[model samples]
Target: MSRKTLLRAGPLWQGGVSPYGLIEDPGAGGLALPAGFGGRVVARSGRKVAGLTWHAAPDGGACFPDGTGWIYVSNSALPLVGGASALRFRADGSIGDAYRILSGTELNRAGGATPWHTWLSCELGHRGRVFECDPYGTRAARPRLAMGRFKHEAAACDPDRQVVYLTEGERDGCFYRFRPGDWGDLTEGALEVLCASGGWEPVPSPAALLKGTRHQVRGARRFDGGDACHYTGGVCFFTTRGDGVLWAYDARTSALERVCDGVLAITSAPSGDLYVATREARVDVITPERAVAPFLRLDRPSGAELTGLAFAPGGGRLYFSARRGRTGGETFEVAGPFRGAWAR
Candidate 1:
């Protein structure tokens, strides 16, 4: 008895535009889609362009296999001049061709996508760093710095154990796992900083009690943000906002489990299931024993804030991203079959 799909509230573009990007709903029951659904912007951010402002801070977006559309802006506050840029959208959403990649690094925001496809860009700034572009934009993008560069916010890869799952966008954040030893090669890794020794029950603070403490960020560092995914057995989830916990770094025994608390932005479900986005705008579904509940409920207008999330491979559809006051952002599409259905 698992079948309840109904989510359709399309087209709503206010002054700030709104919608960061999210996907899921290639067809049947995963349901979710918003972020240029059919496209048609071609390109934007006019005016002399220093970093192409409208305030600039578009934050994480991806969709390709041939559909083409990639976005990642940053300049919420930095040396600006490409503190973090990378835009390319054309499925009609317009805006194409803009690649600075990573500059002085300050706000970069949500980034992840690497089964070897490259594009890890993170930097929420306090001392954040995590760059690895190459989605065809040539090369020259550095900073793995052994992976301990702080403030980074979303990264996940595990091509059968190549391993990489990092998220720390501070408010007391820490949850990492990098095992390059020779796996898929991210230079040559062995960076592990996750430590929640026993099973569960921690959450005291100091960044969720720093799970097991083995951290390392001497010298160069900035913003240890959050937002990550790579579920199922190899496990590698992420999300942190002082108390919105949802860690889970287990590449087998690297350990760091906080399972699911509050949640803020996580994506998965080609059947793997695990879609969370909640500052309370809702969107939850964790279960497999962990238990969560509510699946989708977004009306937003009051304060408005819903970061990125994706899952559009061949399921019901679920994609998200939005921002409303502080600088006003945009990206939306929501069509789902959401509301609890897990029994595997």
Candidate 2:
């Protein structure tokens, strides 16, 4: 077994009032927030937003800055019953349009948004590969197979090294890294499966693991049912839904640290603050120091689980999907005096 440390940030990540103070929702939206905070129903499963029904079983998603507006990519978790869709939000934070991508793909799962303003949607139920396309949801001529075809859950990029870290959403899922050949281009890359220093053989099968390619890693930490991943400040986080453990990976030291627990979706704010959406239906904010606290809790009449958590490039707004038990699915955008990098 590898070493594990309990995450406890000193004071910096403790308590600080953001410019966006506690705001209360008007009660119309399902979300119950602090004061000054506001929310809007961006889209829904059976209903249409910009002419496209909100994708079913919305699992993982991300938002990309698009000129004065933004493009939000959503993933569907139900195998063969769902697909990936992209919703374009106008400058005013309204849905301008929506479209389909990853068509013909199975179980479009969790993924990360690339700096290139594209979506790296993963196929969790089928080919176990990631399909890259514009936020508009165009069909990719080819998926980035070099990233390895596995039971993947999420992928986050280290903008500095131009490398991406991927997670396999399995009971014994292995962490991986895809180093692209050219900067900013994910078309070609080398795939490496992680393992212990004393052990090698690339886990079960490098061919099935990498789907037939060679390549990286010595830190074989425990990642049970790794579900969501986010990279920032030389640290990457993996939320293992099965065991409800959060694994924090340090690129600088190659150290894998266990952070929080009972977290599902991990979205990194532009300012480097990490937001965690929990199965408990609450959103917690984690500061650079790793201190975490509940940020938002949603109340649904029909019962639901929060998913597809994403922060806008401007950081003033957040878009996420709420799974409404009998009512179906819903998409929402919460905005306030959020603190972070502004749109350039």
Best by lDDT: 2
Candidate 2 residue-wise lDDT, 241-312, digit = tens: 788877777776667666656788877766667778887787777765555666777777346778888887
Candidate-wise lDDT, in order: 0.51, 0.71
Q: At residue 276, give the lDDT of candidate 2.
A: 82
Which sections of candidate 1 miss by over 4 Å?
A: 1-57, 60-105, 111-126, 129-149, 154-193, 196-236, 239-273, 276-307, 310-330, 340-344
TM-score for every candidate vs. truth? 0.28, 0.85
Clashing residue pairs in candidate 2 (N, C-alpha, C atoms within 3 angstroms)? 22-34, 22-35, 23-34, 23-35, 23-36, 24-34, 24-35, 192-216
Name the lDDT value of residue 146 in candidate 1: 58
Cα error, residue 170 of model 1, in Å, equals 15
Identify the runs in model 2 with alpha carbons over 4 angstroms from their true place.
1-26, 137-141, 198-221, 301-303, 324-327, 341-344
| Worst-scoring 10-residue span by lDDT in model 1 | 1-10
lDDT of 1 by residue, 1-344 (tens): 11111111232111221122344343322223443333112222332232443334455544333254434333232224324444454443345566565566657677677765667777766556677766555676776655655666677776766667677766556556676767655664566554434222211222223432223332212223455544455666666666776666555665555664667777656544466777866566654334355554555444555566654333333445555554555444443443331210
